[model samples]
Target: MDTHTPASHEVKLSLQTDLTPAQAEILDNGAQQFLEKLVQRFASRVPQLLAARETRQAAIDAGTLPDFLPETAEIRNSEWKIQNIPTDLQDRRVEITGPVDRKMVINALNADVKVFMADFEDSFAPAWNEVLDGQRNLRDAVNGTIDYTNPENGKHYQLNDDPAVLICRVRGLHLPEKHLLWQGEAIPGCLFDFALYFYHNYQQLLAKGSGPYFYLPKLQAHQEAAWWSEVFSFTEDEFGLPRGTIKATVLIETLPAVFEMDEILYSLKEHIVGLNCGRWDYIFSYIKTLRNHPDRILPDRQVVTMEKPFLNAYSRLLVKTCHRRGAFAMGGMAAFIPSKDPERNEWVLNKIQTDKLLEANNGHDGTWVAHPGLASTAMAVFDGVLGERSNQLDISRSEDAPITAAELLAPCDGERTEDGMRHNIRVAVQYIEAWISGNGCVPIYGLMEDAATAEISRASIWQWIKHGKTLSNGQMVTKALFEQMLKEEMDVVKQEVGEARFAAGRYDEAAVLMSRLTTSDELVNFLTVPGYEYLS
Candidate 1:
């Protein structure tokens, strides 16, 4: 496929395609390049506006969806116990409501690649207060305030480490309301000053001057990536932080993102961690994009398969693209974690393993773990993919790297201080608490579990951590290591507990009280693509 040789310093690339006569003629005339140049010129302003948004993003979550968006945190040194979370590859277990060591959580994560996203999005149903509460918990989780373990207790958050280690996917930037809008209002983002609003978003919040990271969703083009990159650059400049500290895990959710992967990846490579294939949105996008195609067909909502030929093609392309560029190639969402019915749960687990194997074999290094319960299992799959106990370190670009490979593999110390830990915990708690009352974690974790799942309960604990999380029962926790370890564990633990509670017949208390767990049926529902029903 790659007949072209690599330049001394450049990657060689080629595409194998059977083009029609008309397409061949356009290529000969360089029309594609001309069109691309035109697009870049026209799209410059769009990206500039997006960069402005990233520079000042705090204005968002004000319950006002800006016409535009800014885009898309951590802390360290304290005396939290190191015994509560994972620390080594062997510590795959996470404790709920009870105290465990952060070592265990780290072990679980490094042992496997399951990222425990403390969600205030799709995983929960959603109520206004719950949104607020979920945001608070997210802030706490980031800070490793283990006590935020229960928000009802009103504990303060305090953690240590870069919160980015615990990834988060926020609410989708869709219409304010689906079925209907107010007589005069007609939903948000339609008539809003999108560019200005978007500009102010990142500028305001990320300007806070430290730790900026996010998982961007619903992105659809290279133009969008460029816009976000500009915002990040501006925010870093204004905040006096290093450029690119604000890394993003961009989601290739819609059809356009998939087709334009080269562009998006090119635009944000320096700042992007990788691209994620959004399962539900991909199916929905296909339907919308191909609605006019007479030959293209789709299937019903319940039957998409990850192994379909088209999916296989899509996965292969993504993998090659990512690897060729020295970036991580992420797998698609494995929604359907273990369910209430053990049989269904086992089935889903098997399906997850199959999908994971496919992705790993195809060259994807990481996959999303939708719920806390699935974290350990997902990590197990990654272990198989990695084929060794050591971290998969990419070869350095130059010989002048600050740290040697041995140093990377060596045991180092990076803990959190009291103030730093408190700072991040505040952010995580604020995120989750805000979600409980505003948007809810379920909104973020939608594809993995049913909305209203108990992941909401963890919001309470995350809130408690917002206060100076004190673990006097019997452990000396350091805000430093726990900052990196147990901090992110709360999210996975919350979601897992939510599902467990729902199963244990505590629906009323677990799901209802955390009412922010639900979303309007329309928001959560999506139209399935015909002929592709087997690829979700």
Candidate 2:
């Protein structure tokens, strides 16, 4: 990919390759200049903060377990609250999330949920065309003009009269948009997504009585939240909008971030509306952050549900902190999709009901569902709790004693078996294959699986191998054992996917990547970082 500069701009914005006419319209001269400004002003801080992450991780590796910050104790103890929530964002009972494809945008907007998070992060593959096309599709949706017709079946899709409130989830700080470069460096993917979306559709959103809303993913610390706050303030100033026009919900998905929730909220209090339980990634973060600790190894991913002590502590603490700060405490995703068989579908609905009930009872103002079918189930749970109230923010958990770090880091109880190990290998390989093939969200074995869940699959295996943990069958987890299981799982995947589909997919490449990740001396920070090279 050679870089070519546009003639109309003085800024050094360059493209990896020439854009099509439609793509050019999305990244026109004004948008390019806005991106260049963002890159020049804020891009340097991304690497610095990422290095801070490593430094903190090194401390943890050297025997310093995370605790609430002493320096920021005043922030936690003092009384404060974020800016008020937007009118449209007040009652987010059930939010449906999906990739930003045209059909998904329309259907999600038309779903029974109160909000639809058009995701360019976990649920998207970030292929160049997908990245640009997502912005175009979202722009059309904001204008209430987006529509789609299935090319295969000719079934039509369009937004409903009262569609769900739209929110965009951009790529995390760690990801880079390799398709575009500022000076010689690739642009930060989050900045590109945010700047383009805000530039293109902020006016329409405001005109329609909404603003530029977003979901900030994978935040690790208050300092990172401070950086995003600066970006939000800068964008608002650039557009001559009000200070808090752009509201965000930060995903407290990392172990370190859990220890610093108060500080995180304080840092972005002007722009943040709430913090979400990105449970899948939180589990992945637990294994990754505590990888060097022998006693902290986790069991099968399926067994580590939210009811586990550590996760329960995390959820309870999130609700307490958010409500205390006058922000909504959104729940985690209910990733089940309805099955075709009646019995199985009934089981799926029951599971979703149980999960959503837990969140609603725990004081979460809202929850997430991956499929439209699960929306009604989640809504019923929240509806029962909320009654006519917009949210459960008024239901505080201050009566309970504070959640301690020990409880938050307690060892999860579960048994690891050969079946679980095989399942991990199979799901990781298949998800990676699908991700490389331009699908980041896929249903495997009934549940909707995304990058965060797949991260847990591989990270748990790596941690197990690192600690030489034993499975329930009395077999020690080793590099050799994982390799053997991977081989068996690949064969199983082949048979399940069939010869034609298996031959056509990138299973071999995915297997190689998975093997490298699980066996490497150092845990990779993110699978997508390396896998991004294979997106094209």
Candidate 3:
């Protein structure tokens, strides 16, 4: 294999922080070659694909309902299924996810779960140092030497000898690794993450009984999955690996993706292993995808439980589709962090248990948790049903299963209480402050909140305001009402975090950002896009 390093002139490194010589060397390894190949093939295609989203939205705005694609109806009706579920991926009863920070990487991998999805997406704040250091940490983890001693607490942490199988969740297609510029354009964050990890650690992971595995996030359509398939193939061929060496679990987060499940799986059959329910993002997508329709406004985020009709239908469809297609139907994140208070912990655990039980009873092979503490609770639930079985893929859910796009689009009816509005305002401000200050996953009000939660919080506020929603108190929701609530929430946040930390916490910036996002007439696809620009 011949690979040449291109000069710095060929691609500009725009990282704001100074990278040490060693760090630079590691980042530059095979970067130029892989990036050049990625750009040559896929750069122009991204814009066109993104435009497809606009086209779909226009149809929705024009009152054409989204449904299973007739163009790919044969793919749905066909008897084909994804092939070759590797041993590591077969029994994913409980998967834990977190940012790629050193402590999280160590703890999550050491948590005794089946899979640890080290995320560069929703749970991570993509600062240049964070992204590079996350890469470095995972590399060390693959080599079985990821360890850290907290300087403040003097506690040492290391991975267990037998760690969870690692699956890297790259940034969604909409995000760019702005620190790295290829041909004067920000490199796609997905490629930067996928290439660096694959180039550096694929062989290492393969030698260690695991191969290059990924959890693809926020993919909107089958074409995006097809694009990922080609990238996987090209990377494998470039490195002299076999065609099917890479395996990906597509997160059917977006509403459009839910409609095109079979086609998405078929688009990458050789490389696809499972389909995950990215539950929070799906709600966020629903809000954004239907932002134009006044009547489709969702209820308060807290009221929209997993068992709600639309989400229930969505999860059922996902499980049925994945099982029928010979893929694991991985469930969504259990965002509750075990509370310190005994009573609160018990309450949270009960909720977690109930949620996990539903997924297991519905034939989902696994589910995700944000904290290691709840891993056992999730494992116990899945263990009860799965016992020794690897998965429930043999259970076929035919195409006529009970879910339709009309049902999916149906309005969720619930009273919008003042407490719910206050909760949204508080969470959006607090989460954004944490995100802009370099933490993306935060435990607030006993639940682990990520960017997805923040997205829903803000988007729901926007939708409510847009539709002139009335709170349970009968006060109309408007920009003025939202701002009033936001200011009160900022005061609450300031008091909660205290004077010194609140001042240093960038809460003011967060307040401004949160308010701006909700007040904007246009819907933003991702909060991380603007939030990334604020990070150091």
Q: Provide the overall lDDT of each model, using Cα atoms, as 2-decimal numbers.
A: 0.41, 0.93, 0.87
User: Per-residue CA lDDT of candidate 1, range 1-536, in tens?
Assistant: 11211123321112124445633442322322322232233333543544543443333223222221112101011111111111221211111110012322333223334244433334432332233333444443443453423357764433434322444444433323111122322222211112211222333333343233456666765666776677556545533555665666677766546656656666776677666666656655444333333233332233345665555656666665554455556677665545778887787788778877777666666676655566566667777767653322242222332222222112212232333333333333333432333322232222333222222222222322333233324223333434443345444445545766435432233222222212111111221111012111
lDDT of 2 at 203: 84
What overall lDDT, based on C-alpha atoms, would model 2 receive against the true structure? 0.93
Off by over 4 Å in 1: 1-114, 120-128, 146-164, 172-210, 339-343, 389-536
lDDT (Cα, tens digit) per residue for candidate 3, span 1-536: 24333344444444445678857865774565676677677766877888898899889878776788889989988898787898888889999999999998999998969999999999989888788888899999999988999999999999887899999999998888776766667878888888788777887888878999998998889999999999999877777778889999999999889999999999999999999999999999999888878888888888888888889888888888888888889999999898889998999999999999998887788999998899999889888888778777765566455788877877888878889999998998999999999998898888889999999999998988888989889999999999998888788878888999997788889999998899998877788999989976
Ranking under TM-score, best-scoring first? 2, 3, 1
lDDT of 1 at 490: 43
Q: How much lDDT does candidate 1 score?
A: 0.41
For 1-536, candidate 2 gives per-residue lDDT tens digits of 12223246575878888889999999888888888888999999999999999999999998888888899999999998998899999999899999999998998999899999999999899999999999999999999888999999999998889999999999999999998887788889999999999888888888889989999999999999999999999988776777999999999999999999999999999999999999999999999998888888899999999999999999999999999999989999988899999999999999999999999999999999999999988988888989989998898899999899999999988999999989999999999999999999999999899999999999999988888889999999999999999998899999999999999999999999999999999999999999999986
Looking at model 2, which ten-residue stretch has the lowest summed lDDT? 1-10
Candidate 3, run of 10 with poorest lDDT: 1-10
Model 3 misses residue 517 by how many Å?
A: 0.7
